[model samples]
Target: MTAPALPRHRSAALAESLVLVGRSVRLSRRDVETLVMAIALPLLMMALFVYVFGGAIETGGAYLTYVVPGIVLLCVGFGAAATAPAVADDMGRGMVDRLRSMPVAAAALVTGHVVASVARNALATGVVVAAAIAMGFRPDAEPLEWAAALGLLLLYVLALSALAAGLGALASSVQSASALTFFMLFLPYLSSAFVPTGTMPAVLRAVAEHQPITPVIETVRGLLTGAPIGSAGWAAVLWCVGLLVVSSGFAAWAYRRRTRR
Candidate 1:
């Protein structure tokens, strides 16, 4: 059988996605628990790590500088994972069905989720960074370095949000989607986020060093500290680009399958 013809009006789809994105952003702002997790929790964790654990870790009196970049990624990762429950709730409540019945592009729903996720992540990152600064984390990076770091974060958020959207679409319930995202919450722990992966045991170290989160963490640290990033920076770029392409395709496929007439 011939495949269904795709939505042809790109302009209309873009407009619809923007409207939906705005709606999602408003809803998120009103979600007190989400606000706590996205903005407050990361800040709390940063404070706890820097104050509670800083003395133990040997970072040459720059522990805050060392850990702030990881905290930024932690904030963004948690925010990206938040998209799964939002998408699953919309699906469970028949919002997807209602949207599919309309004349809008089906992909617009996913795009809206991604755009909202990026906005939320950006806000959360800012909050975490501000908190870090207040807690005595200072970086001497120039404007261009900050721009590059933010750009990397945007790409990271987009990729993970798309993946979370796909996971949400595949889930049978909001609970399941939320459960699946807990892994994302735990991923940073296994990376070079807290301490260097070299300090990990052999097996854990190998896994931590090879995972996607490590290179991204390293890149952020390099950009913030003005240290040489070497191949880790390129690896981060590759991971973001690769994940974006893969996750976007997966999300689109899951959406189509979930909403198929």
Candidate 2:
């Protein structure tokens, strides 16, 4: 009970949590249909945006180039939100409670879901990027720049999935997670996902131009195209960090509360 022992115990808990996350990832691999469904929707978005909808949208840059980054960002949100319903499903099924009762690490429970979500995000990103390239969008950035853009895309997902997993855990059901995810997906779609901020309604355009997703999308576009990677890029990073911190903290608190009860 001594305060001096608290830090050591917490460290041990963290280690256990990480291991559980790994196990969660392994178990998720067996969930084939869920895996496929997660990848499919985002891929469909990529196809629809690039082919079916590309002509109608007029981005300032070449359509594919501009669209690629936005889709990438959108998928990160998609992947994160998509996982929420799964978590909710598990809770309703009492799988989560069963895990809580086991010796498995609590953090691992979150970690596994996050891994699956990220894996799905990567697949989504890959499909979209491949389709974009096929449609004539070429990334002209230096090797390092390309890597940076890819890293940012994944980083955003990493943060988002962590937050989403927490929400999913606390959610009363998977349906609730779906509603929450809709808001997450809606933010970027209403923002700079397909078209320029200038083209939106003046009020919406103002918000779209300044919202968290816009900066990240714009940053990726610039990086991929070797255009100026501006302040918006940094703003995008800050947004990811901020959201991650807030959602992750809340999820942790919620999980503790749930477990304690």
Candidate 2: regions farther than 4 A off = 1-11, 93-95, 102-105
- Per-candidate clashes come to 0, 2
TM, every model? 0.94, 0.87
Candidate 2 residue 3 C-alpha distance from true site, Å = 10
Report lDDT per candidate. Answer: 0.88, 0.76
* Candidate number achieving the greatest lDDT relative to the actual structure: 1
Which regions of candidate 1 are displaced past 4 Å?
A: 1-8
* Cα shift from native, residue 13, model 1 (Å): 1.5
The TM-score, computed over Cα atoms with residue i paired to residue i, of candidate 2 is 0.87
Indicate which candidate wins on TM-score.
1
Lowest summed lDDT window (length 10), candidate 2: 1-10
Give per-residue CA lDDT, model 2, range 91-124, as digits (tens): 6776778878866566666666777778777776
